[model samples]
Target: MPNKRPITSEDLFKISNVGEAQISPCNGKFVFVKTTIDEDQEYRSHLHFQRFDETSSVQWTFGKVRDHSPCFSPDGKKLAFVSNRSGKSQIWVISTEGGEPQQVTQSKNGASNPVWAPCGTQLLFKTSLKLDQDESVFDQEEKKKEKKKSEPLVVNRLKYKSDGAGFHNETYQQLALINIETNEITELTSGRFSYEPSSWSPDGKSIALSANLTDDADYQIVSDLYLLNVETKELTLLTDHNGVYTNPTWSPDGKTIACFGNEREYLGATINQIYTIDIHTKKKKCITETWDVHITDAAISDMRSGHPNPGPIWSNDGKTLYFTGSENGNTSLYAIDENHEITPIFAEEGHVYGYTFDEDRKFAIIGLSDASNPGDLYKIVLGEKKKTRLTYINEAFLSEVHLSIPEPITAKASDGWEVHGWVMKPHGFEEGKKYPMILEIHGGPHAMYANSFFHELQLLAAQGYVVLYTNPRGSHGYGQKFVNACRGDYGGKDYEDLMAAVDFVLENFDYIDQDRLGVTGGSYGGFMTNWIVGHTNRFKAAVTQRSISNWTSFYGVSDIGYFFTKWEIGACFQEDPEKLWYHSPLRYVKNIETPLLILHGENDYRCPIEQAEQLYIALKHQKKDTMFVRFPESNHELSRSGPPHLRIERLNHIVNWFNEKL
Candidate 1:
């Protein structure tokens, strides 16, 4: 009998920290969404809160509902957030001091990003609306089959498919104002495009928002800031030009608005800088010009609900400003004084997701984490060298496991371009014997793979595979030039950068069996895997998930295909079909010699399943070794937040594929 590889389900349910958390304004209280995998293996999220005084601390709120985005009212007496408690996600409100939450807005459409009005009398939210327009593609196909069939008409602006979220039949999102006192909901903006309600003005008469009502492509090109009048139901565009603007936050006095803007260029070449626009004169000033590193998802990091007007808090008198900044892979909190001098607020080593200040601005509530800690809340006061630990959600769970330390390694690319990467040797690695290796790639030729707690990476290490992954060109965390260098030039320099990372590992690590190398990546990473298999026969096995195989067909099928092809290649498909084909992995499938494993969710809207089908068919036709694994009811987020049983099944499938081939 052959020796079987050992496997267990413990790898499937390890503890993980939730991504987003928010704080309360009126008092010394805070709430965060905590995530965990249940016995059934389903990813569940709930709202967890902590209230403190000199005497004692107490925990509040528990339910099976997936509640998230808990923001308190201006009075700090009530909390508003989104929850799927009623089978569908909706906005709800509850008292922060303890009381049953009342269902605030009940609509068939899902609502998110709930912000309380400055007066505390209303709530502003963004939700997708249904409009009467055209028949669905399915309806059209059905009509062809049954001539007499009657179908319903639908019009949606947000028609683009998302990898994690399936076909959204909801178009343009509109802002809605719900009066807390009257329980009346009024649609604020209605159009073909979408607008995100960012924050309310200080006087509560206007709102600062980012939207694209011009066209469908406008949403993709650039977003601009706008001032929306609540009483008059009028909107005035604030910023002029081709800049991409988002996360518009009103200054405490309502005279100025702060937002993050990006200049649209090639793939991930956008440079996001913090800017403050004067509302009265329409004058804009770039606040963090020198700190030009791209900002991810702008937020008033220092403001919490009910504490003040929930926008950027004016230093009790509106002088100094506090915000989050990221530089060279370090995310820290900083304060910009009235003199525009930037100073580090806290000497910390992890990502800061949120923060809020007290009345005196001397103390702050910060949500932070390091490469080791998943995430925890902390209380930081000025002049204090150490932060006070607040929450301990995953402390007990993480203490039991053996964690891998990912060490950063830099290597020169095939073309002499420098590439940055990190490697994790197998947990409890042995000294002499060579171990199999897995080269993991991150998606978002634009996103950077940080040294953070990744469940899958940890599991691979635990399974005795030395995992080597790199932030190739076009990934953030590096400077703009490095990321932009890959734009309009995919599959060229980026591929070489990845190959260099692998070569660096082989040259540096003595315990790596070069012949037993395996490769895998999702999305763009998946595309690279397909590219690698066709270009080299070195890898023993490969897995491509949610990948793009044929750029020709992909331009028509993928949601962002039309815009993304141009963004990456610098030309639309009509203008440069040859360029798209030249970069496609499907073009070289006949030369692929590695045993390839293809995995994709059945309902992935981002990288449609047809791409997977085309690649699998081509490999099979070429007489190459391959297998296709599809999850029925999953989407792009399957690996991270899919159904419990299915997530485990997906991991088992990956392990099975590599085990058999390697």
Candidate 2:
């Protein structure tokens, strides 16, 4: 490791991310997606197959196109996956013995999320379709000619636009059945609502799916599980329609269904819990009601893509269920029995983003990542602690770089609340040299900063800056109370917790330069950075990306602003305009003395560009040191999934600003 160079921003192109791993029914083979950046700066992914006993993996699918969501048939003789090779994403099937792949569906909008039936003769998939649109509209060339001119978007619902997906169309996601032998397609359910298929029953006569069938879908914000009779097309509601439920898995006996969801007891801050519902009685019980950890993978990282949240996979015997849980800065696999006895399976200090159990339950193929490694697939034998590394996707690139491994640290807030986080030392650290430190914050006040590989953090550490990132109140992996503690108190105790983290690190680590401290974050973290600069000038420099400066404007502009404001801030702008203005960082911009840099996405609907414009103008009017940078054709996900060149440019801006000020 001594001769290896520090990680560079350009190294982001070299990292390969593994996800959607699935073990074949025979347990001898597994398939996963390996995503990499092409020379054109676009993402390319394909399927990879590997035998359990073999050391090298075979590239199963060939193309520069994206292929993912690999699913095996009941007999494991054929594999089904989704690919955009045909200009639009559609389901494709290939023999396990290797042959030419056959296109199964050719709908106008294309098909995805293919689930093979128990009989293996049919597959269920979802596709976007306009109301009353027929599946026969598959002539792409004809449709292209029929395309109409741009028209003004007439909006009626509150959820009209999204960050990644822009304005809403009339299309709704609908489920359909396709016979692989004859290539015959049949529409199953169609309406204004969208349906997501989960699993097929053992007898292949019924399918379990989730959808919000309520009249007011935009305002209700709750999905319920349902049973769809394959032949009759009769839908039966499973849940009480009071809470959000999804990822329904049928037991082997087909009598009970397991799902992950929770009631809106805490609104958006509610913790996900596992529940079991009897297929006949419609009786539901929360199996993980007493569990303190979140049942979903809330780990945030820029290196991962297309990783799924497959809730509560059932064992072969149906008496036990397996799932991934987030707890204490790690996402690990867990097992639970009918009596609610929990046991840790793969509880290593890393992120277990995806996993799939073989048909016999003999082993599981897990996709895991740590602080130093990007990610890879490993095979873990059931009821054992040992695991065999199956794929070395990023091993070669990892060997060429000296990545910093984060050390876990804890701090006590002013109110005696303990905050948790990690710190990464500079790449080539000398014992006596004082290094500048930068405080990095994560978005989704609800998401956790786990033990996963973050390219941005590594790049910062490589540039001779000690990177400090912490999970203040409102972060996941903690209990429900701790996560909900920051609601309506965004700048109150949460700010104290972050400041305490800096104090704790400075008191413990002597090599950090206190005067050269800098702070930066995005979304919620961006709001925190603005708040930090306005309230205190402890930091010498700050960079806020895709941030929120004014809560009043944010409440009306953001895609989720209307409801999210009341849910997270405890009040709507109509109810208390003064309170919303009080939390607005722009209102106190006059007090900021730190050199501020604002980076925003031009098309970001989550935190609109106006938020950054307001802050930049206010600071400029007051003659404060400030700079504004905007990236066009980008959204809220600019940092993680934006264009390759822009992402690097954004990183370069941050590093340059800190290098100049710190």
Candidate 3:
């Protein structure tokens, strides 16, 4: 292969996407954010609105401003959103019918996830509380004095390292109530940690939110549902126990609150189920189980879907709730009646990540995607069952690009457990020639890899390689047992599943060169790649990103380390360090023969840099084949949400390494 042109930052930024979905209170109108690149190579996003009658969609907010999280007033007269039009992100409001959006609150720190109060006289949102200015002189003097000594840099946890947005302040996101009449803002909840405000009761007496208020354990940041009395400012914890709880939506009458979250298990997998809590009794019931399916993953990329929460829409009478799930391959919308009987509202072969219902429930605004399309918006008219395209947002951009389709394939593990995988044959593949193959693994071992569109996998296929990605044990879309089976058994059966996937591909795809096989993955996928390289030299090369090499060391560094380690390994660090060491891939580092590439973000609290450093140092000490790549200003989310330039650079590096070594 010939050396390609050096990668540039502009190439990376060009691949970023802009997506937002909002609804009007009257269910008569809808709004969504449209993002694009300008002539100056700057990204811009704005709000667009469309009436239920399809009176034509029109851009609402203007200028070079990037506005998102649009919500309509109860009276359907005003719209609220977060915009940086004034040089900094602030809350603003505008009329739904027409008129300039009015700036609500101004602050150097940004405000986000705005929600209209039921009374329409006020709005509730979260804003970062700014810290005092930092004195760089003191830090410089300290560095100079310590130049001769080897001392570790100490940072304040509250004002620690941030990504493209620079260092953070001693700030935490707090719930704020803004009076639309006087533009006065009142802080409701304040603390070192942040609170995600989801919704307000229909009567505006209480605000429902999710936060990690109790149990100061460093590793467990799982949020639980809470209700704050608006008048007294009293906070009440609603749901308890080990599971993560968020996305609280108030029932029409304010008697019950609906939220989505997952329960932690002994295995690495989590059961993301939907629950309904009775405010009066504080009793909870898992509503999703009635359908025999779970709302495992929610697809909203913005805080608008209420981060870490279930973005559920209540029926007109408030007797039913509707959410999205993947029970039969593709994601679909399911409705749970008041009686708790769940049934599919709509099922399609394509993916339906989420839906926004109009006030009347007559129309549903949805975000959808297929094997070919990354994402698109649709208006599904109830009763009539008509699907209308709201915007051809990415058509013009994607039309010029060549995309590949994912072909489903089956593999059987050594234990005879059937594994599911998707293979992307090299684009423009030659019929008779054998091509190098790359096995891609997904993170969350619990997360499934379906026949959906994958940008990275497709790019590799386009570059002339057969990309094979699989969802072994612990992956979703399968039942609970298959996923939980991987618990306390890290490199065991799950590893065998991956090996079977590779063998199945080699046997079914005759054109694949067995000698030129490679593997790469991020997080859990990265963990598996590490295990594979150590256990067998089948792969000619490998790239592990933000991966864990040693379970013992990993149990101390990651954000979810304590609970996560115990859950996955079936024992806490103090109880069974030996078991953790036994499952750790780094334990067999000396046995690894394949050349390896290690990548990690400098500030990944989930899987800290030390994990990568340990592997790199071990391999280098052994004088084995290896290389390490580090992203200075990145977190565990580098692969998905890092700066455009860095993400592309990261991908290119993987491609470069595999191209040269395989």
Candidate 4:
């Protein structure tokens, strides 16, 4: 046999990935952002250029600073992208061919979502600011940072802190335009509200956007589409429904606008659907309302490749729309025609995370990831489903590594619901040898685990553990009622469904050692791991990462606590503390006999460290075999997007704990 090695964190860093593919308008050449970790342990994403007809790709941008979101000009002469080479992220314009990039905007807070105006000489981008604050106010704030004194944040809004971006007193992302030739920047919309620029109108005089301009904006998840006039500074509202509207792509004739949103029928757990609006008549209709799939991008598997919200990609004729949605545990690209019939475009069995097409939308540049691969770019012919692999960013690593491909497993719940999952046997497995197994759960409680590449799962399998991950009821891509089943019943059927899955795997797979079984998960998965240990203690060892142990404390401290608690559990601490305790894993901590490893991030705002703190204290007080490993300067996304070194350490911690306890 050829010499091969198990995949490691350092090997994963060697696997450079690509995303945000943009096809140049001038020549139909492709330019995308390639992301990788350098020796210094910082993420470096730079633009790279390639011709679809060519066999190789070449680097376009260099250095350690991150560069991404490549958008070609209308004429395709230059490309606009957000880069932080000069300290803060700003829009930079570079030639289609190799050339020095020109800094177009100098926004203090930074600029993103760069879209070239139809006029080509101007562009629209997004920037955030303090409420009722102007550019000069932020300029003064930047000068204050130069003095090197950390200022105290005074927060007043109910939704003052976000998971990734913390402690925003009063900030709103607004749209603006800049004249490239003259370096003159024009603010498009201003107010206490934030504006997300979706698409500029064909005439370049108006732009489509979404914003919630309400006093209870934090409570209200819905936003209305507003058409802003570039010259008059006038705003016209379109589709004022009780749903969040975003990413409005204008039709070629400018008669309609396609947007991705949902009526939020299930509150926080609602699967987003595609909707279209008549710009002239102000009439709106949900196109994918009955489709029973999440219209937004749910294809999340890699921390290296950032998840860009998939769109209602409009064909040049506007008669058809293409988008990425989850179905049958896989997130792939699909299309909807004028007859209201939906069809799969590049709908194979994989995670189609991001895709970009030309003005005509006849062909597309796609980014996909599978069980054995990280991610790569491909070219797809819209009508024929012809795919041409464009770049193999992880070829070298995958070629040299021995990765186990997962086998699909299905089990019917006691309530007759079908649960879809996969099982990955350990590498170098020998026949008739019993191996220790692990039950893996996904986060989001709303997110699905699909036929995509997962680094952690593969790493666990490499360490001689059979990894099993499934998409339970609360996960997206499994239809409306099924995805909504876990809501108001967190530890009830969701718990049963997981146990049934494990029972099914153990019964069918003889090679799995039932006595040496282990369980681990993060986020909602973390909560389930905690729940599993506290409820039954069937697993010999368990590792819970960034988890929620107490719901009462979770309802107040978590970023999404205010709304998520009432939405998921159907009750709150203020309403009924008993209901919270009934589902909280901490409530049954006295029964936990399984050795539990609690992994938490100190800076995790969504599931605060206090959740882990309470669980650890309770377990220790009860003399339970429990250990809490706190990762400082890390957030909830530590597994996927945190510092590279810390991520390796986390993996090492999990492996060490499992190896020691199991």
Query: Total backbone clashes of model 1?
Result: 8
Of the pair 1 and 3, which is ahead by TM-score? 1
Which residues of candidate 3, in runs, are more than 4 Å off? 1-18, 26-28, 37-43, 51-57, 62-65, 97-99, 130-170, 191-193, 215-222, 262-268, 290-292, 296-310, 383-386
> Pairing residues by index, what is the TM-score of model 1?
0.89
Candidate 2 global Cα RMSD:
1.5
lDDT of 2 by residue, 1-662 (tens): 68999988888899888888888888788888888899998889899898888988899888779998899999999999999998889999999999988988887888889999999999999988765345342334224467688977667777878888787666688899999998777789887788999999999999999999998898888999999999999999999879999999999999999999999899899999999999999999999988899887989998864377677889988999999999999999999997999999999999999888888877888889999888888888988899899888888998889988899999999889999999999999999999999999999899999999999999999999999999999999999999999999989999999999999999999999999999999999999999999999899999999999998999899999988888888888999978888888988988999999999999999999999999999999989998999999889999888888899889999999999999
lDDT of 2 at 434: 99
Displacement of residue 196 (Cα, Å) in model 4 is 1.1
lDDT of 1 by residue, 1-662 (tens): 01222224354465645434455664566666666666666656677776645322353545666777777788778888888876667788987767777887766567778889978989998776655553221111112243566655453443455565545555557788888889888878875667878888889899888876555553456678899999998989888746778777776677888776765644347766667788989988877677656554221110111111233445666667776655554566777666677777874656666676765677777767655666677788866778888777566556666666787889898777788878888766779889899999887777666534566676677678899988888877676787788876778888889888888988998999998999999888899999999899999999998898988888877777877888887767899899888888999998999999999988887788899999999999878899999989977666766677877777778778877877
lDDT of 3: 0.75
Off by over 4 Å in 1: 1-20, 52-59, 133-165, 168-170, 215-220, 265-267, 297-317, 338-340, 356-360, 382-385
What lDDT does model 4 reach? 0.85
For residues 1-662, write the lDDT of model 4, one tens digit per residue: 13778777566577777788888885548898888899898899998899877878888889989999888888888899999997889999998766799888878788899988999999899988876455521242154344666768876778889888877768778888888889787888777788888788998889998888766887787788889999998999897657788888888898898898877888878888888899889899988777888876665575553566646778877789888888887878888999889988888888888888876677888888889778889888877857889887877777789888999999889988889999998978888999999999888888888888888888888899999888889988888888889999998899989998999999999999999989999989999999999889679999999999999999999998988888898898999999999999999898899999999999999999999999999999989888989998899889988878888889998988889977
Better of 1 and 4 by TM-score: 4
Model 2, TM vs. native: 0.98
Count of backbone clashes for each model? Answer: 8, 0, 3, 0
Put down candidate 3 lDDT per residue, 549-630, tens digits, no spaces. Answer: 9889877667667667887777778999999999888999999999999999997877888989999999999999999999
By summed lDDT, which 10 consecutive residues of candidate 4 come out lowest? 136-145
Model 2 poorest ten-residue lDDT run: 133-142
lDDT of 4 at 45: 92
RMSD of candidates 1 onward, in order? 5.8, 1.5, 5.5, 1.7
lDDT-wise, the better of 1 and 4 is: 4
